[model samples]
Target: MTASAEPTPDDVVSAAKALHALTAIPDHSPRWSNTAEPTQWTATHTIEHISDALLFYSGQVARRADAKLPVLRDGRDAPVSEHLDNVLSSAHVLAALLRDLAEERAFHPSGSADAPGWAGMAVTEILVHGTDAARALGVGLILPENVCARTVSRVFPWIDLTLARPPELLLAITGRFSIDGVHSDPDWWWQSAPLVEWDGLPRRRDVKPGWT
Candidate 1:
């Protein structure tokens, strides 16, 4: 994913659509069963992590307007096909919820962190961590160029586009990997609070140093 244009909700959906194809890949393959390279989590565990994170974000948006979002998990311990199904389903649900919340100007907070630009957060996970899972399976997983570019712009404004490709940059920004003269920094973070002024929404008292 190296496109330069900003991403839209449509891009998020298309990325998820791309992820759905993983279900068809044979789970019995050694790659699928092996531990994810460059990371401790297995391919199945990484997919499960993605699914659960999306589920937690969805809860933040769909739960009561004034309620503090609870940390949630999907611990089914199911087979590969079931995990794939869970990932696809969770991604679709999160995409739709993000679109709706952004459109309606709804309040969505994860703990004390508010995510007005929810689409960027969702797309970032799909591309960066999705790559983690795909690579572990010994499969190629290139995100749509435009989607990747948009995520980089929205979430990692400090990075120069010329420094590296968008997907690689995104991973580095999230502290997932390092690149030449572009290693992950200790203070990396995304603009999760309202990027624009949205009056009457609950916001954090102050900006935190850590990444969301």
Candidate 2:
């Protein structure tokens, strides 16, 4: 979140492991006490979506500078177990690439992103979708404040760090919460551009220059 706490490959790895705990695959038991948040999709569908996203991001991150992005496989029809594996494998691959070349810049969505940006994005997918999966399983999964804060720091650098709360603010800027006058008629879109020197404060979409 701070200069000393920039996200790394290890951060992504740990978030993946947290997702594993939510799914209850390895333990072979139901964890109704998930303690996380919620989403609209079913558990199976949500997990599948996250797995595909993880794979896709891995593909983009693995691309060399100026290299074309690779086509990734769709695992939506795979069993939930396989989807879980896909999530973990892709996360590991992304982690390795980020670990090696985190500082190297690459184009994503017409803009370049640094290593922390990638890592934060991956963690966001896991934590948010993982919470959805957990909730559909009749459990709640609350993310740690530090993890949520770090994720915001990376992807949503526009957030004001001073007015932060763990999942509440995370969900708000992620379009899950309705912040007054902030604007999310559809949903809040996170920026993927390099934000190395940008001010870490909330940006209001409805406010305009010389209007207020």
Q: For this target, which candidate reaches the highest TM-score against the unseen true structure?
A: 1
Q: Write the per-residue lDDT of candidate 2 for residues 30-93, one digit (tens) a residue.
A: 4322433444455666666776776666676777455436555543355567777777887888
Indicate the residue-level lDDT of 34 in model 2.
Answer: 40
Residue pairs with clashing backbones, model 2: 34-140, 35-140, 35-141, 35-142, 36-140, 36-141, 36-142
- After aligning candidate 1 to the native by TM-score, how far in Å is the CA of 33 from where it should be? 3.5
lDDT of each: 0.63, 0.63
TM-score of 2: 0.74
**Cα deviation of 1, candidate 1, in Å:** 12
lDDT of 1 by residue, 1-212 (tens): 34455556666666666676566567676667667655577777777776766776677776624544566565556777787677678777876776666444333332222333566777776776677778777677766766777777655555666777777777777666677756575444455544453333322324352122
Q: Which stretches of candidate 1 lie over 4 Å from their true place?
A: 1-6, 64-68, 103-116, 175-178, 196-212
